[model samples]
Target: MTQSGEVTTLKGESTDQIFNLKREASIYYSDSLSTFNDIKSAFIKSAGNSSLQMVFLLKGKLNGYLTGSKKACLTFAEQQHNILLINEKLQLQIKTETHEAIFIRIDPAFLSMYIPADHLGYLNLKDGMQKNEPALFSGCNLHMTSEIAAILNALRTSEHTGFCGKLFLESKILELLVLQLSQFELRKDDPAVRQLKEEELDKMHEVKEFLMNNMNQQFSLRSLAHMVGTNEFNLKRDFKLAFGTTVFGYLTDYKMTLAKRMLIEKDVTIAEVSEKTGYKYATHFSSAFKKYFGYLPNKIKSGKLSLLILIEDFSVVFENFVTMIP
Candidate 1:
């Protein structure tokens, strides 16, 4: 469903044939899901023109074709990489033949709120530094690697609830942008050499926290930079470095964090909480949770810890033993 060159414009869901990605904040938090089938069989068949989009693979390999005819298959395997396709938006045909995946597709307008909007169209997704850009996630054509994963995990504790969730999520996204650029650097060109001054980096952190708590409303990095009196690009750079993530990553993670907590604390059924978490389906959450936490929710709450995952997370649990001498 894509034309693949110069300009993309998807003003809104144009066809019933396409699955409308459910972004929760829009309904003003007053509306609950119309149904639990939000995440399944989501086929964006024959995508109309779009401005640009960001797709993150949560599981499986998705063969994405630019148009109805499969010119070449885009192999996305459990990675998050943003691509700026130049088109007046074209027909994009998406299908999960290998394994069903959950994708968070965002409009350029929504994305522009955080960074230099020009970079969205300027950055190249395909030409990366990694030779041949390995297709399988195991290979490295894509990132969302465990390294970024570690940084992300630590940033989101149970405390921030509403605020911290947003900050960490944005930080994670910025980190993701850098990682993707690094892959491009590994292949074609070197990434831009711009490091935020130490002080600006400090404020970038504050900006993220502000956005996190207020993501539902409109925002702009330029205005934010001015208010902070820093360059937008610098703020973006430091924001990324300090958080070790990105604006988008922070948003997605923040949403998922709520989903996780709700599942754990609110005692909501997985189906209900999935929608609340911005997931259209529960299967996606199940897969993501198992991958992220090494266990499903029941396993986590059951007090049944895996010997393997436990060792991975807490070596002391396996090595240290206490005994009473009688």
Candidate 2:
């Protein structure tokens, strides 16, 4: 990999490292640690035309807008992926804070080399990029999966150098692209799925934020739909299309995940964790936890299960959880 040394900026002590995997593909890893209390912004320039850019925010919050379109500012949070098609010169206004992110840029022609024309129909993103069309997920925030997260961590922490490193990075990038594109493929043949408008997508995200912030509060489908200015039917349909989960399903997963984290990290009792996670009764919470993780919450607190074992168990249990959802 062709690597560049880190460069510091004036707004704060930030380091940006660029890795040119090949002539047509590159990766930009950025770490920004702002010193001032006030929010700062910066303009970023894109190098290639008609390139597909994927932004993965691993930590902190980032807000930006295209150079000419200040009205449509975008906010990206941790573990969110935003894919965009850059047909012209693109500039980003970044907020200065303690943040870490990875930006991958791929030339359409280079990406097309790997995807056979006959199979292109299955990959909507490839076809769109080839035509210089707007990205299908331009304003949407796709949740990062565990598999994608593992690849990203490898890409960031790989120790191989020289040609071996270049090969490793390129292969990982293609693997990442395949995983991301496969998500879109899942809905390609589903007639129930429809393209969500920007407003509707924003509403879906708003509902997600509301759930994450108010985890202790119980919400019905009707209440959440009304809270986001949509009806239950559309909310149920569009939310599933947008986030790949039913409304309450996402809530249950979120609560269970939070409960697990609390059990492992916080020195709190099962009852406290249960109350904090919106459970009416500790017994009910323990039952749900056991069902979700294949073990009771006390096991986590008692040090019977290690973190690695918990992660592996959660993966298996989550697969069962998702499959049992519908």
Candidate 3:
């Protein structure tokens, strides 16, 4: 491993390496990472500039805690992704396993260039760490679709090195940023999705915690609302307003997330997965899984399809981007 200033470099095999930080007119980033050993935790002070970061966790586990937080604010298990807007220093605690991850940092101005100027005014792309407000466009520990994972793998394992490799990697990074921006553009503005009153939000959160804890069980809206000391109408509306989706939508997504993790990380059977995810019928589970991920659970279990396929497949939907590529 090598170290200089705030950067601590580690060496691995051909597939396991770290590229030095690259900078241009509007972007700055360290090369991709695939580490084979665990190292001590360290601190990374932000550059003060408002830079949005897209982080891909290809393999292993990474735990990141804020300076004064009691617990980790960011945890990247294998095959997860995160988009971070950094405005303060951070402490990283590496787990005792090999880790593979990549980070791409974008200057806000650079990002603005791609976004329509009028739409850009309404976008929340600022660092909210100092003001104690939520950072605009901040999404931490997000799920990694199969397609994105493939792109990350291509970037990580590509034989291209030096200038050509750098150029290729930069192009891939731009592609990813475009994908993310397109996603944001498609999101319906929740004019009605404003923040709920503190008490209502707290109650809604309680309902969410209860649902997560009892994921293997089923409940109606009325029952869930009663459990959390709210009515069904308010529960349904406020939960969606606070969490950006319906109650069951979030639950199903959460269940499938766990199902994917269990299927990949363990040797559990399909029926076992169905039972664990609260489906009495394995067929029901399979159908829901296919609907949510656009692939079968059997494919995921058989190693025929992976989470990366989602990004790969979705990118083809953008005809302009597809035409731009050779």
Please give the range of 10 consecutive residues that has the lowest summed lDDT in model 1: 23-32
Candidate 3 per-residue lDDT, tens place, 39-140, comes to 111112333433456666555666766768869776665545556654444445555534555665554555554555445322544425335332435342
Candidate 3 has a TM-score of: 0.53
* Model 1 lDDT per residue over 1-326, tens place: 11121111121222211223332111000011221123212212222332233444433444444445556445544434445332322233334333322223334343344334234233232222122221121122444443544433343232333343333334434454445545533333325534345466457656766765664455676887776778787766665654446656665566655655555456567777666655567798778777765567666445443333323433322222111011
Q: Which stretches of candidate 1 lie above 4 Å from their native place?
A: 1-51, 77-102, 106-141, 151-161, 190-326
On TM-score, the stronger of 1 and 2 is 2
Cα deviation of 71, candidate 3, in Å: 25
Checking candidate 2 for backbone clashes, the offending pairs are none
- Candidate numbers sorted by TM-score from highest down: 2, 3, 1
